[model samples]
Target: MSGSVAFADTTFIRYPRPAAKVDSHLDYVNELLTEALAFSPRKYQLLPSKATMQQGRAVHEMKNGTGEVDLLWSMSTDEREKNLIAIKIPIDKGLLGWRTPFVISENRQMFKAIKTLRDIENYSAGQELDWPDVKILENNGLKVEKANSYEALFSMLEAGRFDYFPRSVMEIWKEQEVHASKNLIISQDIALHYPAAYYFFVAPAKRQFAEDLTNGLEILIRNGQFERLFLKYHQSSIQKAGLKQRTVLELQNPFLNPANMPLSRTELWFKP
Candidate 1:
């Protein structure tokens, strides 16, 4: 019998949850892995478990011989890369790096005067306590508050506890729609730019799995399947973000490790 490759079901990564199906992100990863493994001599069964992002990270870190999970997909950071093997291919084509703010509709005017990173530093931002982006924002001289729950961050923003909540361009629209009644709106005037990429991570000992994933992604890219898959799920979100109209406030990624940089792979990144 072929061994099974297990992964986490990161529910928060996408929306429109079907009553009895995996989210689009997990589905796509499974499809890509299947296609990749088809070319190799090894055939493996897939096992997906319902778990939060933090829970998945914990299981991956344990790296016990039990094989609870074979992989995880998350934002790449220097520390994570050192602890886990990262397949450096950016799954979203760098879309996650382009961010817009979620502000109380009444406070929308607060960001109007912000034209540069320096100007934006004066405002406070909210992020999940464990997110690597917290350090990235602070490194750029911006003040950030922490929240333990994803949903709680919206409430914090609504209460004016933080000046703004920065979310990815592809994520803000759906979030804004869901929380519209909360009196929050995506800021239309500016988009924050940083070097961020999400990658598939596996235990350090799972080098073969990491190699298989990278090979599969490269083949998908070369055959154009990757682009097709990306557009199918993200095109609508990207179009709705109206990136061209927003002023781009660029910031440096302090957590980027030199070994994990993917800038030379232009075809693998989305340009907008």
Candidate 2:
């Protein structure tokens, strides 16, 4: 039996719940893996794990080769820098072409009081500990709270432990509706922005197989198979909302430059 693709829950930009069970990234991996298997007859598999890393420590453990996973999908550039063993997977244009608003929230009640970074100074900001974004909040003298996971932060918020949290608008939109009566609201001011490229980090031990898989994926994308799959699951409204008047770059061309991939060289952290 072939293994499955490994994934970490992104909850927002990458692994939204609706698409979690049958994500495009997984499809891409599988399609490509099948091609590789046809040619090489490798008994390889794509394992999917629900490991959620909301902090650098968690990322370190996984990237340091201690985790029970062969790949981590939809990781950030900062993560790549931490571990070169991570193989880069192709990201959909939907991810690469957009940036969403950053939001602030707390448990029991959402924090809509602060409008800007400067306004947050009087309030405590809860984020993934040591997250690069915290520096912007801290520069303005805002109290920053670091947590290990989203569950932990939500607990603290519900207990009235923290004042606010920074997160992507998409995450807030989806999660808030589910946790709505739970009192989580987003802010009007945009805090930070990042490209929407999601990736799969392949374990170094399986680099050759991963590279082969990547090549197959590149073929699928060039043939528009990936986009067809993407449209099948795309929610019209959500898709519209996600890509309003934005340039949707097709990641199909082999001649495409690295800059075309929305590649960035900045530190990143999930909302913890």
Candidate 3:
């Protein structure tokens, strides 16, 4: 049985950073939250809070702790020991998602000569400090330089201050067209890979509420509604990557269609 969970939206995805309005993982969470309200009981209405800390702030406040959120969803193993309840989710599959790297230019002899991780390892690499990808590269013995800002990396990479700049493919594409880069090149080998998910964190004071939420998730799974949500979003990315579409199955007894779900019963709980 799977658990139902709510998660704070992840701020970053494979998109441009400086854009005033950026698409975030939180957007999907909010959408699911809205839909679940109508299906679940009234007492199960979960709320999301805005992050109070900005970049450079310690992640301590974000970590699960006593008197803090009851269950933090989709956290790493390191975070679970700190106060988060682990809810096993289906993330081991490539279905989790991917974010590729983008470089600033592709013209210089140094850039033209590079195509893979081994090539970049021969020179100084620039990336955001403490980022997961940066840590991965460092652990692999790749010499990487940390940058404070994406803009800084662009400047450094152009000035030959650094050998390469690695960032999310979508973000780099959104900021500058990759084909337009005459002085930089994206690396061929992936710097790192890990399971990332939007998870729920319950304040210790609201333990019961968290349990109820988990129960709701189990109901969704039992009813086969859990998979619909994932597949709906999953198809878009698959198509974008030129992959075949997946078939969705209503794999439960007494299956029901979410689209045709009547408002009568749901209205008693969540009002539109």
Candidate 4:
């Protein structure tokens, strides 16, 4: 006869909700979280916070332990890792650092002219003020046009307030669809490359939960579940992004510690 086994207590992991509508559907990150937690030994319930927060505010709350949000996902940086318990696994497999720009059709030739990092500097880039990518661009000596909100960035690009808006390959298609009425097109002639890792960062004082997630992710990796799930959601996007056809201009992420990058596990990244 079989009997139901109960755990001591279920851990409710509440991640934050964006202050503004960022996407119609959740990214692959959320799905990865659901799948990973399902494999954990202890029972867990993943939920979203009722409070709306911006990227910077959410990180601040996580750092200070002032919020009920248990964890959040973002590109890892030295500062964030120091303040939060980072899982160190590249959940997005470093795809967030591979940027493809969206340009108004008339300005497509402008991007086509960007053959080098210096050429890229001639045109300003649009990014949220809180995003670590902004600092990366500034570190690389590029001009940036900052926006206060996610939706505003798109509108700014259309209004000619910014020359180009570079988005991750995984994000470009969906964003383009959302703003289909706009004349923006993903620039296939150029891509900006930088080595970065997207990590699930546990809030301050949540070390135990962090370890559990890390372990579950490792379990997924060892059994090849991680790779399979990653490919299922991202392979088609990768192929359609036409990354290989673009002239790759590499950039540096000064805020990230090179030593901290789990590059040895080459399976955790997209090769192209």
Best by TM-score: 4
Q: Residue 254: error of model 4 in Å?
A: 0.8
lDDT of each residue in 71-163, candidate 2, tens digit only? 555434554534634344444432322323323343323333433445445667676664544553455456878776555665566566676
Candidate 4 RMSD to the real structure: 2.8
The lowest-lDDT stretch of 10 consecutive residues in candidate 4 is 1-10
Q: Write the per-residue lDDT of candidate 4 for residues 113-189, one digit (tens) a residue.
A: 66789987778999999999999999999999999988898889989998899999878888888788888888779
**Per-structure clash totals for the candidates:** 0, 7, 20, 0
lDDT of 1 by residue, 182-242 (tens): 9888888888989988887776666766676678778888889888888877888888788
Q: Where is model 4 more than 4 Å wrong at Cα? A: 1-8, 20-27
With a 3 Å backbone cut-off (N, CA, C), the pairs that clash in candidate 4 are none
Question: Which numbered prediction scores highest in lDDT against the true structure?
Answer: 4
The stretch of ten residues in a row with the least summed lDDT in candidate 1 is: 10-19
Better TM-score candidate (2, 4): 4
Give the distance in Å from residue 173's predicted Cα in candidate 2 to where it truly belongs.
3.3
TM-score, per-candidate, Cα-based: 0.83, 0.56, 0.53, 0.93
RMSD of each: 5.3, 9.7, 13.2, 2.8
Question: Which regions of candidate 3 deviate over 4 angstroms?
Answer: 1-21, 36-59, 62-75, 90-97, 105-119, 123-130, 147-198, 203-205, 222-224, 242-272
Candidate 2 at residue 255, lDDT? Answer: 22
